[model samples]
Target: MVVTHRGAQAVGRCLEFGCGTGHLTRALVDRLSIADLALNDLVGDCEPHVMARLPAGQRARFHAGPVERLDPEGTFDLIASASVVQWIPDHRCLLRDLSNRLEPGGWIALSGFGQDQFGELQALGSSASAPGYRNAGDWAAMVPQGMALMATRQIQTRMYFPTVRAVLRHLRETGVNGNAQGGWSRARLQKFEQDYDAQFGTAQGLPLTYDAVWMLARKI
Candidate 1:
């Protein structure tokens, strides 16, 4: 959806925020004719992982750090992210800052988890670390007047796991386990399993919910 939205306009320099493991970066390269790509991630090693996926002779610059602290040399034609932004405490401010970095008419494509992103974990009292998830509707008011929000939508999907461990592993593998904190004791793990099974288990297995909100907006 992001690449398709970007393809609607003329794309030149693109900034891919949270280019973790280069998954989305690779997809963008495969689908767009971006003249330059700037890959940013909090993880230092993400650059090489994404760099390896670029087409032969393709070149991209890398910045590793919090997106808010990232200072690029110039404005961008597109600022895109996937499953990011929710981690940042102040997305309204973050979006405003990002909108300021766009060339007029440039596009922004972002996807983040809504407030119910981890509904199961949230219900299980296992995800109390951060409580600032925003739904697509919440964003309409936060958006700066100068920018126009377009094609925004939110959806909920459930992923089934054989056991609670698989859900834990999914969070770890996706690098979104910041909520796990400290460590899980045997007793804590047992309690978690019980709670999750009792509340969220289905005929398939344990169900993990993902509430994804995606939006396409453009600087005026």
Candidate 2:
């Protein structure tokens, strides 16, 4: 979630591929004197809240669609995406596309949920015979060959809730579990809730952890 290192290099036209709520987009626009900027997200409406914070002159054009659909006519100075790549089916293609769309020596900064994200939840689900999840290393291995890896690291952040109900409620509100297909029946849902509480509940509260991976690379 934190930008560990950034260079003094100036960026001209920047594009944020998956600007979920535009939080990172706002920061980048503030940090760089970018003439043209593009913010894109699969769920187009999710960006309006973030767009409202920009000044009229700085407001960039918004593009709505999958990141893979973005057809860059020219190379950009910088491309940044935060916490969005994991959902994409072909991350390697996206990386290659970014490398192709980057001006010489352009920078690409990305952050995403690693395989270890929701480990406890995942384990509980697994033990209960739920679906499996992908690991971050799989994505890390798919980095484009020509891009020089400047830095790579994993981060873990924990969220503490007063009760298991609160934690589950947060997940529901955030649509974290919405990706699950073939909706569960009331009985199965009850079993899952019970299993999660039995496995992870604590006297004070429940501890939920998110594992994130960050990388910064430059086009060779």
Candidate number achieving the greatest TM-score relative to the actual structure: 1
TM-score of model 1 vs. true structure: 0.92
Best by lDDT: 1
Candidate 1 clash pair list:
none
Q: Please estimate how well model 2 matches the true structure, expressed as its whole-model Cα lDDT.
A: 0.71
TM-scores for all candidates?
0.92, 0.84
lDDT of 1 at 188: 91
- What TM-score would you give candidate 2 relative to the actual structure? 0.84
- Count residue pairs with overlapping backbones in model 1: 0
Tens digits of per-residue lDDT, candidate 1, 1-220, equal 6655545444689999988888888878877877888989999987778888899877689999999899989999889998887777887788899999999988888888788877788777785335457788987876786898877899999889999988888887767657754478999999989888988888999987788888888888
Instruction: Look at candidate 1 and tell me the lDDT of residue 77.
Output: 89
Report RMSD for candidate 2.
3.3
